[model samples]
Target: MRTITLCSGKGGVGKTLLATSLGRIIQRQEKCNVLLVDLDLSVRGLTLLAFQNKYELDRLPFSLTDYFYLEDEDQPALLHDLHKGLAQNNSNAEESQETTAQATAGPSPYERLDGLFILPSSTESERPDWTPLHHLELNETIDKLGKLYEFATSSLHVDYVIFDTQAGLGSLSLAATTLSDMNLIVLEEDDISWRTALNALMEISALNKRLQQKSHSYFLANKVSSSMLDTADKLKAFSFLPPIPFDAWVQKLFAHATTAVLEKDFEQSDFFKQVESRVWQELAVILGARQRTTGNGPRSSWWRG
Candidate 1:
């Protein structure tokens, strides 16, 4: 499975919104098993956008925290079992819940979104005691998370796993970056946002080298106010970085609980046009997705997200 992470060095740049929207589009259009996992310890609310229903999974049975504490067995086995439990929980709920926050159906491998699944950070009420995640412990925990990601793709047959990373440069964000095959950064165009995002981009570049990882990542300039587009001519980053304008209609999708996917005129709005095309283009590069493009095009390689 290919893992894509959306991260920013700072918060409130609409990272979750972008991740959820991309998750929906990729799951529906690509016909791939998509798991939208939220690794934010502060607020694991990405599911609210899609799975508004109560995720009543007992906190004891499984959680990412458990894997962090129980350093007994090999990490792969522990995470594999946890993933299975989550899948079973969704599968059981499938019959009753016809429509999920994203797709109408239960939460199984075969649930509403054929090729999508989401493993949030923790369904538990309180955050796990991160005391155990010391320097060595943190490194090991990330190693396990990375292994879990590989398991999701190879053994479990998931097509894509998108991560809603914590809103900062921390251990969790580092873990997400380390495990990701491709990364995307969603940021605004304001001066402050750009400064913060530049720091994030440098971090992503350093991350790629540190892990000996190879992934094509990009930044999505979100809510591109007229000022940002005007600055594109000056800043090199803004030129190729896909810019998405503000759309009130798309904003409404997140305002309420579950969206009426069928009734929602996503096609009518221009929100999906530029952003969606760029997403597809980025996906193609990351996944080696075949496409007929103009020959002798510029070499495609990116270290920044």
Candidate 2:
């Protein structure tokens, strides 16, 4: 499975929204299993972005909060609860009913986005009350999470597992990105944002070399204007996701509380169509989904399970 982590060193750059849209796009286009895991504990806002009307989170049997917020001794039991909520099991009666689609996805964690799942870190972030990271054992939390991540992806048999991370390059974010096959960074078109993002990019590159592992990373300049695309182009010449203008429709989806991301035909918009063709095309290349077909009409999803 290909694991891609979407993170930003600075906030308010629309990385969360991009992750949400890509999840939808992947599900729609590829027709394969996809999981969007929310790792941003401090701000579990992406949950709202994905499931605006389905905000009955309080009634759910379990959530990611239990695994992270609970004490270490109590974590084992909580982890089981997390698993049930994420992947299918006999204990959960809903899993069987959820398998309306045939031959491929038995059941997934999402509703409309067929074969796509979302594992939110929590309905609410309990960051302040939680224990701070122990510097000496900084890798403990992320390493544990990485193992769980591996298990979850393997069991689900998904085509991709996308992680949306917390703001800044903390141990967990840094660790997760290193573990991921591709690290996607998002930033706005401001001097401070650009400079800070560049520093973090350099840090990640250095970290990859230190770990003696090659990492594939790309910087996506969010909220870019046509005029500023030139500036963004010059910022990262050697490596990046070709920066696109800030998608107005995408921004509209996140800013409004009542907006239904699924209801609208965003592809009709010139901006959305361009991204679907270009940005997502590049993304497919990174995911290794693009293959030169024998007939050469278009790439096929014949290999997806």
- Top model number, lDDT: 2
Error of 1 at 291 (Å): 2.1
Please give the TM-score that candidate 2 achieves against the real structure.
Answer: 0.78
Judge candidate 2 against the unseen true structure and give its global Cα lDDT, from 0 to 1.
0.64
Root-mean-square deviation per candidate? 6.4, 6.6
lDDT of 1 by residue, 65-91 (tens): 555556666565665555454445443
lDDT at residue 82 of model 2 (Cα atoms): 49
Top model number, TM-score: 2
* Per-model tally of clashing residue pairs: 11, 0
Stretches of candidate 2 above 4 Å error?
53-55, 89-112, 124-137, 230-237, 269-271, 292-305
What are the lDDT scores of the predictions, listed in order?
Answer: 0.60, 0.64
Please, what are the lDDT tens digits per residue for candidate 2 over residues 1-103?
6778888878878667677677777767887777887777667666655555554544444455555556678866665554454555322222433322221
